[model samples]
Target: MSKRDYYEVLGVERGAEERTIKKAYKKLAMKYHPDRTQGDKGMEEKFKEAQEAHEILTDSRKRAAYDQYGHAGVDPNRGGGHGQGADFGDIFGDVFGDIFGGGRGRQSRARQGSDLRYNLEMSLEEAVRGKDVEIRVPTLVECDICHGSGAKKGSSPTTCPTCKGNGQVQMRQGFFAVQQTCPTCSGKGKIISDPCTPCRGQGRVEKTKTLSVKVPAGVDTGDRIRLTGEGEAGESGAPAGDLYVQVNIREHEIFARDGNNLYCEVPLGFATAALGGEIEVPTLDGKVKLKISQETQTGKMFRLRGKGVKSVRSGSIGDLMCKVVIETPVNLSTKQREMLEEFDASLGGGKHRPKEQGFFDGVKKFFDDLTK
Candidate 1:
């Protein structure tokens, strides 16, 4: 019987791209696979048809000939086809390589080591100005005795006998082939006859290493500094991983930071707040004098430009905001209390304190309305 068109078998357009053809074939293969269909003859035929269509369309030469002259151009009987033999394993590998972790030929067993994280706590002053700190980390380092070979001196590792150094062993499972790591070599591809004493058979040793890290200026909490190749040593002489230093800013006693800005509460004497005087405010750099205006109320904010932290990423300096808190006089002497009473009596009720007067007036109005 005449065969169906390749594009029709895969349910793809005549001018479909290679990726589109592959996707269609994958869908059909998954639907008509013998394992899924349970030995149904009809589904088996459909699977073979889809597989054949994928083989021809994926090959540039065969696809070109098929495109120009249809199946007649690729038929082995017509003496115009490429080699008719196609490995079903290769086709499955191409479609499901990532899923099963098989295919892509042989891969090296030597893999990079795992990355590590270290939490570094810094004072606010140190974070703003930047500082170099020495930190000790306990991690896996390459064994000095065997030079990461896992073997004794004057002897080396040999290829795994069972897997022939392929690192993986293929297993046949009822029309499907799967690959798993070799049990004997543990996927290292090589076996050490004589193990190193320091690290045993592992090729790496657990030890403490001290490294100096330079903290960049204006780095806040949660910032990370990467030290390349400073993490755990890789297996079998592979490349080492990285060490990430995570910054955690310690809480400051007087200052609170938000983004690049700094906020601080400044307690001012009632006389200084009312009579308008200069007060010394603290900053990261040094104490700066801030002028308080006359009749300054509590909770008033004063901004000092460029006195805050500079952003590490943007390099933009921020302002420092000081919130004034009026402190009332406490523990007055008998004479002071008498003088304050006289002073309060001398001022007409509400002339000296407008805010206090306004609040009382509102309260009076609210009570009058309630009575009415």
Candidate 2:
């Protein structure tokens, strides 16, 4: 029986590119693969024909000869038997991997190290001023005995015979090829028959490393500093990963922070609030004097310029806001009580307490309106 034309079998034009030919083959491979055909001989033969066409078209040299001489150029009895030497297993992997999921294309060793995070809590004082801190981290490091080869002293890892250093092996299920990690090498592409004493068969050992970190001023919670190559050691001598120092500022006792601004409540004596005087207010740097105005009431907000934190990003300073709370006098003596009563008698509600007078007047009008 005469063989069918390769392009006709793959359902592609003779002038199709290699990419188009591969796409056509992949579609047919999925539809007519032996495993999917359920023992249908005709579908199995169709899949084989598509495979032969793909193998010939993908190789630049073989494709040129086949295009020039037709089937005679690729006859097995002649010098065209190999037909570009493309591996059918690779073609199957490409088709099935896309149909199922990706990442099955190729495999390799020398995996990168895993990234690490360390949460460090600092006081508000320390976070504001900034300081250098030393931290100890327990992580995996390269084994000293075998130099990350996972072998005994004077010995090294050898290529995995099962996969020939490919780190992967193809499992065929009725011509449906699937790639999996080599069981013998565990995907490392190497085997260590003689295990290391310190790290056993693994390439890394657990050790505590001390590192110094400079905490910048104005760093708040959720801010992080990355230390390159300070994390867990990579497998088989790959570069180490990064260590992230996450900052968390603790709550302050006297002041609360909102962005770069600082807020604090200041207590004022009743006499001071009414008569006015100079009072000492606490700040991050030191105490500063704030002058109180005459007849100052509670809940008055006072602004202190440049008394708040400096922004790390913008380098701009914020203002300090003080909310005043008037404290009432306590534990009065008999003389003071007599003086207070006399003072209270001398004050008129309308003149001395205008706010209180207005409140009572509104209450009386509300009751009068209700009655009407």
The TM-score values for the models, in the order shown, are 0.69, 0.68
Error of 1 at 16 (Å): 59
Candidate 2 residue lDDT tens string, 1-372: 445768899999766888899999999999999999999999999999999989998988878766544453455443212233222212211211121122134335775555555668788888888889999765667888888777889888899999999989999999699999898876878888777776765777767689999988988876889999887676678877677787877779999988888999999998899899999999999999999999999999999999998887898888899999999889999999999889889985688888889999999999999999
Each prediction's number of clashing residue pairs: 0, 0
* Candidate 1 lDDT, 1-372, residue by residue in tens: 346778899988766899999999999999999999999999999999999999999999999766544453465553221222222122211221221122234354876665555668889999999999999876678889899888888899999999999889999999999999999886779888887766665677667689999999999987989999887677778887777787878889999999999999999998888799899999999999999999899999999999999999999999999999999899999999999899889987797899999999999999999999
Candidate 1's displacement at residue 245, Å, is 1.0
lDDT of 1 at 234: 71
Q: lDDT: which candidate is best?
A: 1
lDDT of 1: 0.80
